[model samples]
Target: MTSTPGERERRTSERVIALLMLLIHTRHGYTTAQIRRHVEGYAELGDEAFEKAFQRDRALLEDIGVPLSLEQPEDADARHVVDASALLLPEIDFSGAERRALLHAREVWSETRLQTEVMRAVGLLVDPGSAGEADDGLGLPRVVQRLTPNLEVFLDAAVEQQVLAFGYRTAAGAVSPQDRPRRVRIWSALEIGGAWYAAGWDLDRQGERLFRVSRVIGRPEELPGTGSDAPARPADWNPVEIRDRLLGQGEGLRDRVRLWVAPGRGHSVRLRGQAVTPTAQDGAAPGEGWELWETDRPAHDGLVQLCGGLMGVVQPSAADPDVVAEVLAAWRRVAEVHDGAPPPHPELAKPRQSRYRQGQRERVSRLLDIVGLANRAGGITKVELADRLELSPKALDADLRDLQYCGLPERLFPGWLFDVDAESDVVEVRQAVDLPAPIRLSLPEAHRLSAALDTVAQMPHADDEVAPAAVTAAARIRQVLADVGHTGATTSVRPSTGGTDDPGDAAAVVPSAADGGGAGGHEPPATPVTSFWDVHADQDTVRVLMDAVARHRVVRLRYHALHSDRTTEREVEPVQLVQSGVVLYLQGHCRTAGAMRTFRVERISAVEPTGEIAKARRRPKKTMLTPVDTTLEAVLAWHHRIRDLADDYAPRLEAQDADGRRLTRLGLLSEDAAIALAGMHAGDVEVLEPAELRQAVRDRALAALRRLETAVRL
Candidate 1:
């Protein structure tokens, strides 16, 4: 593994966790022995390897930030069961904007340092959320295709731990530093700046270095793997420990360096006046004098500039004068980090593989301050800190050890003490870290067992294109159930409100996804199953036709009328897709229909021979069948509100059902028709037409009520 042992370990641990989540949800929960057996199958190695790997994995899951829980109920008490319900997977919530942000990150990583695992994670999170399942139907073929071109090449190179000879380029246009062919192991493929960069360990050079993806020349050729190159630290590792280790590596600057500030007309520097004590001369004349320090330098420019202006450094020999400029340049590059357009499906945007922030160092230091507020007064047990911080016993143990090393409290026994090192994994503390173990998970049935969870976890968010994602998800759930040949499992689609989930049983794990299902809480598992079949063609084709119609282009259609006996061909200019009752009716100047008539999609012969839009053709002016504000958004909101009220106004909903017993599609018309429809649905329906249309409906309702009163008196 030319890649850092840390990277592999982290990925392996994530894989283990992902697997465990799938298992727990599938088997409800498992015991320690069951977990060990099941985890061994997820891992490539044997029993010994699995046991060692599992112990480390268990500790990592319990760590702070990772956030997992363990429990032993009164019934499962003696079994040491792993309470998978406490996984807190549902606690992870991303806002619509945040969901959008995650998709944009895909473009950012389109090819950059954060490529492989980070990009994969992002894609995994987003695809399932939006567009039901990210597939060719979502029109993200380009994304997958683009990534595909180099995936196998990189994967092969990564696995081989061999030197990959290739040409390289940099954004700075820097050519290769080496004149001759250099042998090096490709450590990782990076996706930054919407471009790919393959960073590798230069055998000739011992330090870590970056490469620009665009500049790479020649086909990537991988050599054979080497034994020394595949050295391992551990197959399982804790991210918190890794972070702590990175911190402990050290910090300090020996020289006082001058830094030039950027061009900001009114930018002022803020200082932590209480923290840095000043000398007489340095304190008196800030810009003209320099302060000396024996510790690490402040990385933030505001602080650096404040420190510099308060105590100026004398321009000396050799230190880079462009240091400030360099930092500023990096800042400028990152300012647009979250600015890219979201992936077509917002769900594709997920949290990063790893995050790097300049201010994290300060945050880490502040952790010490926070700990002091609690422990310094009266020592807290590992369990207490664990509960407060929501850390697991193993994590609490590690935190305690780290605290102990910090000269806090000593000994595990309760006392009014706080002089123990946090780094110490005390035997007592480790033993005290009691947690529920895993339950029986069948590895052989992992995929089938996780169907519902996959659907829930990877659902889409409300966005443009198609109908409300909730409806689409409901439809997709039907597909999932259909695929599994289980029509008995009814589904109800509900909006995800970022709520806590039902605990313990896997079947109770019903999550509100970005989009797809039936009445909420049929089961609590995350359902992220992929829809292998294409469902978006109808909507997509309709969109294309609508675009052509708007642009006055002659479009070809390959329509498959689901209700019709067969598919058919047509060439027409679409005017509008009308909501005729509950079904979508296309109102176009159809060559076949021969008039400005509406054809229900369910009845239209398949739209065949769909090709390029003939934009030169002129479209006739017609009534706007749908609301001008009928954006993907307004439309979704309209439907979502209607669905929400259906439960409350079942009678009204039933009235519109056509079939009296079932509450099916509730139809909404253009503003003109909404009031008339409201009368049809009545108190069984409330005109939830966004207040813009409120008075119109209320007036009509009042008028109708008056008329009814007049008739009753007669």
Candidate 2:
């Protein structure tokens, strides 16, 4: 009888497992004829079918990192053998602090693309039952940084010392022609000011250069046989220094400028500067409750970024006569870009592909992990084993049956390589088949672990008494990978500490000067040092709030609400700190309002302990962490050029226009947020529906323009 597709796959899998077991367990390897005779499912196949199946299975095993090799005897056919020493990871015994650090890294990447890889890597070290129970992030501040596909490609290439070819966009937002792809050997890649960057040897230029990752036109391609020819990275290469030099920061003339800030606004800016009495020479007389503040900043471009980011709320003083004009010009440039027509074609569209193959790889990884886990436990209950592997009882039974077929040839040995006692309540592996330890980390897994640990290193520890566990753990893991010939780009990429200094700047959504202009020649205003992962809260405030959350204490907060432009003092029962997009929030029950509320951590100016234990309250549901309100919706239109930005809203594609612009429906939480989102992309995005929202965006831009005009007259 012909077998069904599922049955055929199962048979193939069992045959492969048996073949691997025989090769790994036997001292003198097995020849082709011996393998077919002993491995299950192989003897049932015809000569042609068996040859095809054996070749495919051998390739699969090698693809999954099984170091399979062939040995030739003096007077016999070649024998296939598995290289056990190269396949297993060296045993590592982690300390309490190191284990906690690993757990923290896992939590940080839980929602990212690296989640699966990171979880599997951590699983190799911690007990499956206890891994989920650790409160690793209890007293630590959290910062979520996004890793783009291009960034990951560059990271891998940096490790392998490969030369890359890709189209690059200038700071003015013009993409180089395809034929003129920039060739570079990346020495280092890193995150600075929330943007990803790579510093490398520009082959065409024959000198060191930095490329902002966001400006890369398309997926980079590796040049054939180029890594070996590239020069070694300089011993003293520093990514930070390269970034500062390229951006013209840290070595410029400084100027003291006064600003008129509106009340309850610019809280972050307030922290950086001091309040001053209003003076006639500063600008037009302050309106209503506006107050004057003074700050010393780098001249010209830096001043423009600071004032432009604070836009309407901040007016430059006469101390720097050209500062106001420069800021106004920058805004006009951005406005011009917004008012232009859409691009003829989309520039940065991401490829959407099925993840079926990825799922298959993960399953193979799990199977290998199970071997190590069962061997280490000696014997474990079937239910416990199923739970640990996240498989149903039926699925676990199938896996066990497959293992039963994997063993030495009957002529060579008496029993199977693995004695899986499925009939009993307990499942035990009597023979390990030389796979008692977990496999070495893959390149992607190593990069994810390194990046996650880098974020953990940047986080402020809640308790001063505790040592820096992340730093120590990172060093140990790096050494292990290095010893095994896996050199990942760990030292290159890292999280940035720079953030928007003005609280009002959160509302400012201008494009980076380094980004490309949409469809027109107009460029965006130079934005303040901001990251794609916008972290607004001060480190000290985060530390205090995290400590309070850990202790379950009631704290008083002086928060400035961006929607209402009001500053209010309230007592809140700290519950959990959550991150939504680039913004971090404190979810808790507010004693002052007598209700549950979510507060933006950045807008909070002061946090003081109320000297009272938090009252017993039900925790908010997981859905509450989402910032968007799905009930409200808006229609938006944008050229394919900004598909990356449009995808952020998880919009539904509505239709396509003749101009190659896409009409998409997006859910909105508030009108202000929608406006900010549109303004942030300049004119790349258009609000097609919700006439009120469209008007609101126009009104906001006009108001800012009027303010700029008035400042110019002063």
The total of clashing pairs for model 1 equals: 90
lDDT of 2 by residue, 548-583 (tens): 887788899998765444678999998788754434
TM-score of 1: 0.22
The global C-alpha lDDT for each of the candidates, from Candidate 1 onward, is 0.33, 0.60
Residue 612 local lDDT, model 2: 88
Candidate 1 residue-wise lDDT, 1-714, digit = tens: 287864454345334433334343433445655554444243356778776766665554433123234556677632333444442212124444334434433321222222332332333233323423322122111121123234335433433334765554333233354554435554434321122334445554543344443345456656566424432212221122211121121134222343221221101111111123443322221122333232223222222222222111111111333543343332222222212321121111221232332132122222332243243323444443443333467645544544332221112123322245455332222211111221111111122222222222222222342223323333443454444343322142321111101111111011111111211212222221111111111344444444544445655554443212234566776655443112344666767666554455433424533554543433335433333332211111111112222321112122222111123223343553444333322222333324544445555444433332332233
Q: Per-candidate RMSD vs. true structure?
A: 31.8, 8.0
- Candidate 2's TM-score reads 0.75
| lDDT of candidate 1 at residue 678, scale 0 to 100 | 37
